[model samples]
Target: MAQDESLRDLYDGCYRRLVAQLYAICGNLGEAEDAVQEAFVRAVEKPRRFAQVDNPEAWLRTVALNVVRRRFRRLTRYRGLLRTAAASTPADAVPGLSPDHVTLVAALRQLPLEQREAITLHHIVDLPVREVALQLGVPEGTVKARLARGRARLAPLVREFAEDVEEVDHV
Candidate 1:
């Protein structure tokens, strides 16, 4: 496909999904959207190179994930100021994610970066383990291991979230 067509198709196929995937990883909707958009921009800048890649969606996801991670690391360098700013920012100023969703996102944030990425790619983005392996440049077995470890870590958090929901239902 031509460059323009490929970009259009990529936007159509992966834009929203990538944003959601990034949100799942980053726990910040604005950051997630920005990361995915930046990834798309980078992909467009190297259309020919990207076109030759085997799995474009995975490529985009990896790029977006890197962007988010880089942004987080940069922000962490100014952690004090960033935390103050984040605290002062109204909840409504942020995108409208539900409380439960926010809790789940916080749980994701508690995991190690690789574990979170592996879980997001496999579960949130619905990518196969092999594809996630390709995206992260790891072996499939590594992806499997990360997924297992991540799930084990997350299981209690998920159960807690579920219990919260059940309690709310009883109210």
Candidate 2:
């Protein structure tokens, strides 16, 4: 009971902030929330392990990020299945996605995995180049190169979205 109360206090303190960070990482609030919740679940299940951690927030962040990564990998496999099974175009907005957001996500998906991950971490998640490099287990130079190439590729794809937004605004 004492452990549970302490864990509950930790959750209340961390949940919203973690959700924001994970949202930036994953670009989906629901996925971010789910991943954060899963991380808390793990912490609760292993109170001894959680208690011994030097930095609970760091542990939670790492666990949540890992959950997001694993989910992304699994979703990539299902994406191919969806492409084959669903006649609809991939850009069909999910329940909460604005058309522009859906279009942008679809564009991002066309990138190679490394480039996508690099760009998303550096740009979307707002991590610095060095941090991205560290997280990706690559040299800083490689991260910079990926960012350059990803930006070059994303420019044209995202340009259409910008145009659409402008047209909508004028109309």
Candidate 3:
């Protein structure tokens, strides 16, 4: 198959799953989708290598993950500076999404960085421990430790949201 056509087929086959996995990492639907899409755009620049890859899905995923990781690292470093410099617009107030999504992203943002990445990769993204460790370039035990800590910290935050939901339902 011509490289371009092959890449198109791979994109058609993999886009949805990639976005879902990325959504776990990014905590925002638009970001997840956009990151995956952009990865493919970059892939087109090297269609020959992309076509020669044994597992296009894995290659695409690694590319997408790298993209997200770079962005995460950049944002982590910039978050405080941006907070001070940027406008104080509320995400929920921006419209087009439920308040719950905005709240969830807010809570996710408050998590310790390692914990957030571990939980999202291991749980929400549905990667097994070995894969998570591989993707994170960490020891398997480290991934486990991060997941444990992340879950423990997240429990109270998620519970608070759940309690709010229950109260609303009962009202």
> What C-alpha lDDT do the candidate models reach, one value each?
0.83, 0.77, 0.75
Model 1, residue 81: C-alpha shift (Å): 9.8
The TM-score values for the models, in the order shown, are 0.80, 0.64, 0.77
Any runs in candidate 2 off by more than 4 Å, and if so which? 1-10, 24-28, 52-55, 78-113
- Which is the better candidate, 1 or 2, if ranked by TM-score? 1
1-171: candidate 2 lDDT, tens digit per residue: 898888888889989877766654565677879999999989988989999998787688778878988988887789887776433344463466567656666677667667867886777657799977867779999999998998899899889878888999999
TM-score for model 1?
A: 0.80
Tens-place lDDT digits, model 3, residues 1-171: 576687788888889888866765666677778889888987888776766777777677778878887887787678777676534345466356567656665566567767777787777667899988887789999999998888888778878988998999999
Rank list by lDDT = 1, 2, 3
Q: What is the TM-score ranking, best to worst?
A: 1, 3, 2
Per-residue CA lDDT of candidate 1, range 113-151, in tens? 889899998897788998889888899999999999999
Cα error of candidate 3 at position 55, Å: 2.8
Kindly report the root-mean-square deviation of model 2 from the true structure over all alpha carbons. Answer: 4.2
Candidate 3, overall lDDT? 0.75
